[model samples]
Every structure is written in C-alpha cells, then in structure tokens.
Target: MRSYGNKLFLFYIILTGSVLAVLGFVLGQLFPFYIVNYFSENNIDLDTDQIDYIKKQFAFIITFLLVVSFILICLINGKLIRNLLDPIENITQTARELTKGNYRSRAFAVGPANIVELRNSVNLLARNLQEIEKIREIENERLKTLIENMGSALIMIDREATVSIVNRQFLDGFQLDLDEVKDKNFLTLGLPKRIEEFIDHVFLTELPYRKQIEIEVNQEIQYKQIYGAPVVGEHGRWLGVVIVMHDISELIRLEQIRKDFVANVSHELRTPITSIKGFSETLLDGAFKDEKMLISFLDIIHQESNRLQMLIEDLLELSRLEQHGFSVKIMPTSLQEVLIRAVELTSPRLDEKNMQFNVDIARDVTVAGDFNRLIQIFTNLITNAITYSPENTTITLRIKKNDEYGIVEVEDEGMGIDKSEIARVFERFYRVDKARSRNSGGTGLGLAIVKHIIEAHYGKIQVNSTVGKGTCMIVYIPLRKKRN
Candidate 1:
C-alpha cells in the first residue's frame, strides 16, 4: 500500500541502517582488540591514566567516522533519486500533452537504458499520430473542395430533418447564403413542398428516391431532376439523406419546341394538300368541261402546291442549319455585289408594291461568308420590307464598314412590329400578322432562316422597331481583308 516515493525513501533508510549496523558489528568485534594488540606488540607500557585517554580518543574517532558515513550516503542517494526521476517526469508530461491533442510533443530520451527505450517508443507513437492527423486533414479539405465545386445543387439533411450541409452550388442555385440555410429546418427554406415531402420520405424509409420536378422561380417555369439517397453509418444506422438536383429547363423547352414544330408543319401541309386534292378531283369530275372554271381551279391548285413546296424547303433548310454537322463555306466575298444581287431578285416585288429602293453601299467592302447564304439573307429582308410596307414607301439598303465588321441595315417605313413580339420575330413559324403573311405569299420561316445564316458566319443580327414609325434590321458581319 506504500506509494513509490515512500518506498524509495524506506529503501534509502534501510540501506543506511544496514551500512551502520555492519560497520558497528565489525568495529565492536575488532577495534578494542586491535588497539590492545598494537600497544602490546609495540611493547609500550602504559599507566591507568594513559589507557583511559586512549579509550576516549577511540570513542571520538568512531563517532566522527559514523557521522561522515551517514552524510555521504544521504548525498549519494539524493543524486541517484534525481537521476532516476527526471526522465520519468519528462515522459509523464509528454503523455499528458498527447492526451490534450498535442501530437507534436515528445519525451527526452535520457536516464537508464530501459527508461530511454520507453521514451523513444513514446516519441515514435507521437510522430505516427502527427502524420496520421496531417493526412486526415488533407483528405477532409479535398472532400470539402470537391463538394463545393461539384456543379450540381446538393443538400444534406440529418435524421432529425434538420438541414446539415449545403454546398456552394446549392447556395448559388437557390440564391441563398450560408446563414440562411445552415442549421435550418428542411421544410422552411421556401423550397417546393414536394422537395420537403421527398426528404421526409427518404428519412422515414431509409431508401433512395428520384423524380423530375417542376418549379417556378421568378415567375418562370423550370424543370429539374432530383436524385436522393440515404446516408447510412456503421451497422446500417441511418445518418442522413443527400439530395442532388440537375437543371433540365433547357431540355424541357427544346422538347416543347419540337412538339410545336411537328404540329405546325402538319397543319401547314394539310391546307395545301386538301386544296390540291379537291381541285384535281373536280377536274376529273367534268369540271374540265367548263374551260374558264377549269383554268381558275388549276391556277389555284398550282399556287397552293407551290406554297406547300416552299414550306417544305424552308423546313428542310432549317433542319440542315440546326444539324450538328452544319457548316458554312467561309470565304472573302464582296458585300456590295451580294446586296446588288439580292436587290435585283426582289425587284419584282418592288415593282408590284411600287416601292422605291434607296441604296447606299460602301465601295469595295468585303465580308467572310458563304455567297449564296448572304444573298438569301438580304433577299429575305428586302422582300419582307416590301411585303409589309405601303406602296410608294422607300426601302433603304445601307451597307458600310467599321473597325472590325461590315454592317448592313435594311430599313423600311412599314407597319412596324410590337415591342413585346420583337424578341420572338426570329423564331420559326412566328408571323406578326399570320393571315396577311399567308395572303402575301410569305413563309413565316424567312427571318428564322436569315438568323441561322447570319449565325453561321459568326455574325450578329438585331432588329429595332417603333409601331407606326418604321423597322430597321441591322446585320454586322466580320470584315475580310482584300487579297492582292
């Protein structure tokens, strides 16, 4: 039951006692006899007074020797105990530091061989712990960076339905900050109720879930695909659920456009096809006997057939333009020549509408594009201006060059487009006045084709219009250097 300190003190006391006892026993047996023998051997005769003085001197000598021996033992034991305990004290301090998470601490390898070995082992353990801690920290940082930059919105909720983690993508996508979401409830973040329901279901069932969801943000409908999975810990313990969302708004929009295109094409073809079939059947049913009626019906049939052909050609051209492999033949060509050719082609409409052409083109201005596509672009613009403008109104074709591009503007004092519909003018099958466009022999794909052609040349086209004032279509094409 004695502590180490008490045991050490007791050992020191016992060793001192044993040394004194042994010295006392030897001195008791031999000291007096040696003194008598020395005096007898030397033949030195003494009186009673001389013997008494000698005995007193012997007692004094034994006492002084015992005192010196005790002092030496005490000094030596103190030095030995200090040497034994100092290294052990250093090792204990290091252990305490390690327990406090200071893995860099190390004990000094001093003292006896065995103690030195223990110190070295402790130091080795500390170094290993430090290395392991460093690696773990690096891995944790890498995981954090990966989650933040994963490009898909991600949210994690614990079993308590508390939002635990939201990455950078989730914050940016939802227009939220860390303070708004961290440690918040899953149902209270202004998220669609369906998302909250899905999270609750995941937590209750401890299973994965996936669905396509529609959400409205800023009054615009958006489609998203969500993937949810349960996060489980050791021994299948439910930890949390992780949800990832991918935006599919563009895909949904494209699908809608495709459906609309199919329906419009069908309707456009059906009208012409019905007219041609009816006229042909009538001609075979003795309507040919009346020459005047026969000629009128045949002409109508021919016009309808031509309109159908034009619609099909426009659709095919648009499909080609949108194909992945579609490419333009880019070569330096004269912008002036292209404009002149387009003007000549549209002169028939100009003559019919009695419109005046005001042409102003820069001399020798060149552009990089396919010649036929450039001609098509200008032809469509001029024809549209002629079709929409009142007779005798001037249509202006001004071509010029700036620092980096050749610019062309086809302007008209026509019944202009509305501001709200201006943005959608280049969309296929979009017409400002559908009935008027049909009667004027106009295909609604003209501006759409013009846009595709301009985009192929890496150029831009824009429209500016004020109702009842005028409309101006501006095209900017990259200028090409003249070859010597």
Candidate 2:
C-alpha cells in the first residue's frame, strides 16, 4: 500500500512537470515569432545582439518558472497522497487486529468520503464481532454452570478417546479428581469395567447407546442408568462421545420393595381370609349342630377376623406415615410420662408373656415431639419386646438424656436377630421369626411404623443384637430447648 501511494504521488508530479514544460516550450517558441512580427509591423529593425539577449532572458525565465512550479506541485502532491492513504492504512491495521482476535481495535474515520466510509464499515464490523464474542462467552459460562450443577454425572471424551470434560457430579460420584481424569485416555482412567465397556461401545459404533448398569463401589452395589452418544459438530463432523450416568439405586430398591410389598400383602390377607372361609363353611355344613365344635370353630373364626383387621389397619397406618409431607404435631412433652403411658398400655401383653419391666429412669427428659406419637412409638417397641421375649424374661426400659437428645432404649432378653437381618427389621412385613410373629398376632408392620414416627420427630433409631444374647432398640429424640 505504501508503494502504491508513492507511485501515485510520482505520477502526479510527472504529469504536472510535463504540462509545465510543454507550456513553457510553446510560449518560448511563440515569443520569438511574436516579437519579430511586432517589429516588422511597426517598421522597426532589431539587431542580432538584442534579439539574442532577449531570447536568452526569456529562456532563463521560462526555465526558472517551470522548475519552481514542478517543485511546488510535487510537495503538494506528496501531502495529498499521505492524506489519501493514511485512513486506508489504519483500516488495514484494524483488520489485522480483528483477525488476531482483538475485536476492540477500530479504524479512524478521517479521510475522503469513500475512505471514511470504508473505515466506518470496518469499525462496525469490529463492534459486531465484539458483541458476538461477548454473547458467546456468556453462553459458554451458562453451559459450564449447568453442567457443573446438573444432577446426573457427565463425562465428555474427545475424538482421541481422551477425557476432555467432567462435571462435579461425575468426579464426586466416581471418587475421582480432575487431575487424575482430565487428558487421560478414557480406557485408562480405571473406571468401572461396565462403564468403560459402555463408553467403548459408543465410541466404536459412533452411535447412541443406553443401558442400566450395576457397579460396585465401596463394597456396595450401585445402579446407574447410563446414556451415551456420539457428539457431532457442524457438517456432521464427529467430535467425540458423551456419557451421562444417573444414579438409580434408590429407585431400583424401591421398585423391588414395591413388588415384595404387593406379594406380602396378598399372602397375608389370603391366610386369614382362608381360615375364616374354611371355618365358617365347616360350621355351615352341619358342624354348628355340635355345640363344642361350633364354639371352637367360632373362636377360630373370631381370631382370624381380628388378625385380618389388625393387618389392614397396620397397612393403612404405614401408608399414611410413608406419604409425602406427613408431619407430626410437635410440643414440649415429658418423655417419662410418655414412656409410662406406653408401659401401661402394653402391661397386658407383658403379663401374658410373663415379662417384668425393669424401669430405669435416669432423668425425666423433655423432648420436642407429638405426645401421643411418642407414646405410640414406645408402645410398639414394648409390645415387640414382649412378643419376642420368653416367658419370665425381664424387659429393661431406660430413659436418659445427652447434650442434644433424649435417649430411650428398650432392651429385651429375646432370641436376638442376626447381624445381617438387623438392618432390615424396620422394613414393612419383615419379621425375624415369621411363624412366631404371626402366631403372636403380629401384623409385621410395627417396627416400620415405629421408624416413621421417630423420623417425624426428627430422631433416629439404632438396633444392637447378638444371635443368642438379646436385642436392644435405641431411640434418640432431639431435646426441647429451654426458653429464658
């Protein structure tokens, strides 16, 4: 561009100089002829010396004027050339900056109309590019935030099969760090075999794949719904593969529980219904004529009906407790009073089992809970103890308090549960001794109900048991704070 400007300036200078030299030659030629014509018209004669001197003076003047005019015109043309090219040069520089990702640069709009317009266009382009860059940055930030906070674990692999991106959930779920996973080959990240296989399948096939996979972590089984697909860019270019894992362990367990619950309910209901139907039919088929048989059958039917009623009521209670937003009425209640009432209610069962309560009241703790619900919790616990313990066994009831909670423990000298089964005692319809519990008129929902009630009171329950020694049920309820 600079060379082009210099050429243009040189052309102007040459054109101006050529025009001045031609005019000077024409005037000098005509000057001699005109002077000779005037002398001839006036009847005057000129000497050779005078003509030669005048011609010499005219030649010198013409030469001087032409030289001065050419110099002045060259200087003016130089300034004009710079004015023409400066804005263009600025626009070019701005374009270079734009290519280098410097969108903030702008050309100066100072030149002729066309050059200034060009500069303005470049500036406008820079503004648009800057705006687009800003929008892109904002969108990228939004995408990053969404990925980081999303519920499911996400991992992105590049075309080279290297781990390019991983979300927080992915890192935490896999117990991994960014430094360990990033830039590492997907196959070499020590991921679970199942997950790695799935990722490999997607990468090889370059297609979408989905499956429910089981992975063991920390000695526990976890269920994940895995979804993987090949990521494609514009023009259908294959970029990489993305894998998303959603933890569904809880959902799977709940589904299994649902199936078990349906089966259990049907079996439980059928037993008593069959007993009542069989006994009633027997009585109707002439057994009622025998007074002894009739009374015996009637007793059996009455017992079956009672058992059915208890089962139904327990099922309903558990359903309500497991419902969403189920709340218990909370108040400052005397834990000792609640325990006493529960003991009184279960005293009949205690007598039937020939069980004695060893009441150990360390402190009458005040707890924040629903009074009736608290009584119900203890009542069920005591009833379970009495049902499970042998005759003449002592059930110990202890009331104690810690810094933050009121602790109640129901310890019984019963056939203790196995360690493996201890964790499942709170499940509905789960019983350690199914025959004994059913024969003792247990609905099998007592512990489940007790668990829900305690949880509603913002408390926790723990069980400690040995196979032959005894079982201890501990309940921890938050203590009520005193007001000044």
TM-score of 1: 0.59
Clashes per model (N, Cα, C within 3 A)? 0, 0
Instruction: After superposing candidate 2 on the true structure, give the runs of residues whose Cα lies further than 4 Å from its correct spot.
Output: 1-137, 159-162, 171-191, 217-221, 234-238, 286-295, 322-326, 347-364, 385-424, 458-484
Model 1 lDDT at residue 264: 73
Name the lDDT of candidate 1. 0.87
What would the per-residue lDDT of candidate 2 be over residues 1-484, giving only the tens digit for each residue?
7888988988898899889989999989998889888988999889999889888998899899889988988898899889878878888989999999999998974977898889888999999999999999999999999999899999999999999999999999878899999999988877889998899899889989999999987656789999999999999999999999999999987898789889999999999999999999998999999999999999999999999999999999998998999999989999899998998999998988777999999679999999999999999998888888889999999998899999999999999998768867988889999999999999889999999999999999999998777899999999998889
What is the overall TM-score of model 2 with all chains considered together? Answer: 0.64
* Model 1 lDDT per residue over 1-484, tens place: 1256457866896889788868866775578778878998999887778877876778678767887887788778867876787788788889889989899999984987999999999999999999999999999899889888888889999877788988988887778889989999878788877777777777787788889988866555778899999998999998899999998888877787678778777878898999999999999999999999999999999999999999989989988998997889999988889998999999998999888899886576888988999999999999999888888899999988898889999999999999777867887777898888888877689998999889889899989999997899999999886679
- Candidate 2 residue pairs in clash (backbone atoms < 3 Å): none
